[model samples]
Target: MKIKVIKRRGFEEPFSIEKLEKSITNALKCAGIGLEEAPKVISKVLEILESRMVKEEVHASEISDTIELVFIQKAIRNPLWLNAAKCYVLYRIYSDAGKVPAKFSKTDLSLSFNALKVLESRYLLRDPKTGRFTETPDDMFKRVAYAIAEAEKRYGASESKVREYARKFYEIMSELKFIPNSPTLMNAGTPLGQLSACFVVPVADDLNGIFEALKITALIQKTGGGVGADFSELRPKGDVIETTGGVSSGPVSFMKIFDMATEVIKEGGKRRGANMGIMHIWHPDIEEFIMSKCGPEEVLKNFNISVAAYDSFMEAVIKDKKWPLVNPRKCPEIKNALGKEVLDIAIKCSEKGVEVKWVNAKHLFDKIVMCAWKTGDPGLVFIDEINRHNPTPKLGKIRSTNPCVTGDTRILTANGWVPIAKLFEEAKRRGVIAGIVEKEREISKLGEEKGYETEILVPYGEKLIPTKAVVWKIGLKNVCRVIFKEGFELKATPEHRVKLKQGPWVKVSELKEGDKVETYGLWIKEATVERVERLGEHMVYDLSVPGYGCYISEGILSHNCGEVPALSWESCNLG
Candidate 1:
């Protein structure tokens, strides 16, 4: 017998268990309920309701009430689940009453109205039954503070000491002194406590490696995280594939696979995830990679393309000399070539002859600048400068940075990584720097074949083995954008207003890369053009400032820069 549900209107519709499952799943995300377990919550609620009501027709309100009852009961025993239940109920009430709840527990913090809404939507415990906020801003602060502070307990801190740290954390937050990243704030103290905001997954050159990275990318985005990848390792277009005896499609073509996947996964229909696509300056397909995002419609919107330049490349540009572009497969570091060392490698391929092409350094640089002038993309990352500050030389070189966070975290390594936090606490008690080596030694003893990937702990007690192909694992803080704003479009071009101190002020339509510009955000700041792109009628420019990167379209340039005067900056993060 179909369970017919009466809607707020007079119409009747069949009840959908899938619909109920989705509701429960969304509510559980508020508390870190896994896919495997969240369905059980829905089954429990449905079971309870069916036992009480056997009628052929039931009001939607009655169904809503039964789910609420189940939520209330479960939440009481597992207090963390209360947050999920709260959101469910609140959303249900709003549905039935057609009004958002006005009464909320008051907190001492002085917050903007918009800020309060953000806290409610993203941070506060919600009525899981209704998908609404039930906890206040104060409640969120306490939860996050206590959760992060608990990490100190791993340091052998006494109970009193840990509690004091938690108190201090709460004080800082309540005073509006410090705030964690979105992941920390949203998942903290919850069962799904993934603290990192971004993941840099490696896309190995081979078929399985590429798909494996794609799989990891999907998993990360599903949890509302971003990813960064360097595709310089993949062979260029028209390269030979020995295994299939076919020509290779190259990195730019393969990127579409990741791009299409992103279009579908799209962070569970909430927000499409973002990616950083980087290509080395000397890669055989550097030109193709740079031009990949160039069409009128633009390809790969989910990605931020950048050229990974080394100091030597810039030196070649200054000297106006021919730079050698090497085939990625020919690097001397590649010891094993899947099978018997292929004789026709990049060094001296009998079929293709020498795999090196020399192009005017300045000419290549100009191409990057010109493309960037049209599209605010293919920015440059000075790899030499990045590796200079790396603390872990033993791990390997840093190739790219995550688009979701700022600065180089220097956690780059080959062949995946042992979960830091999962093994970190136990490792730290043993020692500090030496303990990491000790853990590596310990893991190594398990045999490379058998212990290649170890199941590691994640927030919310989820066990996962990190991807082996990844070369970088960035340390992340909550992005201010996700914390305060909701539903970010994937790589939407931003409109920027330009005010030049004493030059011709024009809209983005006329803006070009390498233009000196004045920027205003936190006070005022000086900025220079890294790249620019024309998306239809509007021109977008990527700005490089002191510490970070920012992009905007000339459409936002309300004031003419021809009349403004130059001055010092208060603060800025555009890169």
Candidate 2:
């Protein structure tokens, strides 16, 4: 059967059922739809168009819409057919507006196909990995483009100008891609609205407060945010319970609840929630807090531990003395206070040996350095440093930093690095015994002034800087520990190498390129030495330690080198 209609432009167009069927079949075949399904859809569409009893003014849009209705009713899911339906609908609309040519020429088909492919590829079925996609509804594309084009045409703009604007608009839209954070991506712009990276809640000494903190922490974890708590405010261990007259279990016991909470409250059902458990040095159960993260199997696998070192404790360590390990509840004055006076008490406690084991400051410092050297964690946050640099110091002393020891700007302005030594010195200058500087001086002298001989091996492109304080063993397999002015120490192993000035000198093994090394024992790690230079008789190894400071190490010659026992060479014969 054939149906012919003269277009309004006087061009006669003939439509054959067989031809329509063939076109539909080809489109469906290209779309990967089965012929059996495609024929039924095509037949329904052809029947509607053939039965058109309307005037010649009937638009192609109407015809395309009818076909689309049939396909939709048949539940057609073919991407190609869906795109073709949209393109047909758009063409019909354009034809009704007299914008399309009367005769459906090869040029028209080619233009429509190209336009449809671009639209579909840009909007439909986005690639999951690359996030790019194919065409969307042709009507929608035309609608948006037509609005812009019409505006430009109204302004008397040339077609080229309108097209250039359209291209620019599309380019902008293409780049406006957003990847939300874990929580926001999972929930936000969705039904569940919880979105946060970290949450901090108070845990009072009461049952309600304790459970409340745990519940909130659990909820935050459910939405995929880690939690940290300052357990210092909790009552001390062995404190008389007013409610039950029994001894309080203290912060350590309460921490177990949080530990259990972390164990059960999985983050979005994927992994256990991470937590940060902090206790002040003065807490009665401070020992448990410090040792919590130690041992073969840490009790809380998801928790990072930190001991909030107060001013006095640091002072005592500087003075090579003992520190007081008073419970926060007993020493309420130390709660949110920052200054040298508060530090004096900690120093006095250290002298009395009442605090957590008063060993050499060097020992504790060594342990921390070693752990950081190994695991890159167990971060130290000098409480005094945090409080001093805190912009809101007037509000209250910053009791805790973030889990990573990177201070939160909301509480402390200098969130990245806090100058503890400067603050301590300032406190002393004000006639406050904030720190035992004299004691720190003695310890520094004892460590840095000692005749420590270390032989270092340098690989290719490596050099050694000699320090007046350090005695270098210019030979192979030599090892020595570097004691800094502040009681910080590091061990360097040097390799034997021949140099111009010295007959044979041991070059400390320069860390491989890209390896992180630290200097001045200042808690900074991962600094790389950029270049090495010589200063007169001593070699200056120019080094850069990330986030802390840069320094140079120098070698010292032994006075007894000339009188050293001579090695007698003995010839051995192979028998």
Candidate 3:
């Protein structure tokens, strides 16, 4: 039963039955065929190959021909076995071209396994009829690059120039010098040409205008574009609808419709639909708008909610003044046709209800802050700040921010620390952290053993740059919020350490009340530790700071010495 098979390269090698069976199995799997008869089919193929191998050495093609001949004969016996054999036949072609490699070798274009999974699931071009992927990742990049470069040819480039630009574009992509948005990568060179990732749809007051915006929003979301809309123009709840002779459902009710519509539409059959809803702070239903995302369950989870806030509202909040919330329909000037067009006003069907609510601006601002703390929604958009540099004010005010916010490079901001790679870049500019980073340019690949993990550097107090300190600190760290079960709490980090007029600066973990030796202020008030109790994980001590504020673990208490009386803060934060 000893045999040697000849390869296409004219080389002789020992025949492996395992190899043949695995290849056939893969083919069957690719064709979505069952493996019930696979063992029998592989056995039969083996028998045929052995019978045909009369000589000590047999050609590989002969083995293939005998297997295929058996397939033709099996077709006469039963169509089931023949289908499996035919799958094997097609698998041969697929393996030679479309098969993903068992392993990715080290190369510039090589992708990670998960990256390949994502691309294979969606981005790779497939035959619509067969539902089989017809192109590889390299093919996708080339398709996207060439399709975009073709735009140059539309303006007046020759065929040669177009090809040259295509080559340059291909090089740019292959070298990882540039990458376009996901929609472009997916739809380029395909029938669907929509490539943008975000759209700002304007919602108008009337039913016609409102539905029109909803239609356009649906169209954009269907094509993988996220949409943002300003709902401030719509009248508040209980406002009259002149056309229908009924009360309006209001902007929030319409927002629910938009949310439901987005839920129904799956963007590009791959990405989920996304939306952003913005309402002005002066809207009469501002309180209702602020509390929209609160209290347990949610219907508009797909949306990123935001409030359009101006400097005047913030000023009112600061001065603790009663702010006027006005209905656009109430004023005669606002209701006039010319005023309506410029200011976006609509007539209320009746005037029986109160058109304005004068609320304490501080209370409204506190509510917004509290809701935002609960769920990371209702991000504030500073209206005055945005328009301070508006390029075209003549066109009208910019009401809604785009669905996606694009920024230049990676920069340090109030949001934690920058990326590790960004930190390394800054360190290089300052001539630091090279020894810490060594040669690993990619920060993600670094680990805890390498003196780093996933962490960002932020500022604490003074000019001190601190970190979650996992990686070489990016910047100073700041203590933002102290979460308490019902009161104040602090972690046992070195940052929570406070100084005493004795020994060295000790951690809040070590000291308790009645153990203090030094006077805090300009003179001693002759006070001993009043009380100590454990609230959850925090060991809090009563080192009363005149303001009824107690110290925890003797934790950093000086910084929070705001004489503004003890307040029940779910998240103790200072601006």
TM-score of 2: 0.37
> Global CA lDDT of candidate 2, please?
0.44
* TM values, all candidates: 0.51, 0.37, 0.49
Question: lDDT per residue, candidate 3, 378-477, as tens digits?
Answer: 7787656654554544422222100000111132323532433453334345431111222322222222112221212222222222121112332222
Q: Mark the regions of model 2 whose C-alpha exceeds 4 Å error after superposition.
A: 1-180, 344-377, 388-575
Top candidate, metric TM-score: 1
Model 3 weakest lDDT span, ten residues long: 400-409
Candidate 1 stretches with Cα past 4 Å from truth are 1-109, 125-128, 268-270, 332-353, 391-575
Mind sharing the TM-score for model 3? 0.49
Per-model RMSD to reference: 23.4, 23.7, 25.9
Point out the worst 10-residue segment of candidate 2 by lDDT: 566-575
lDDT of model number 3: 0.53
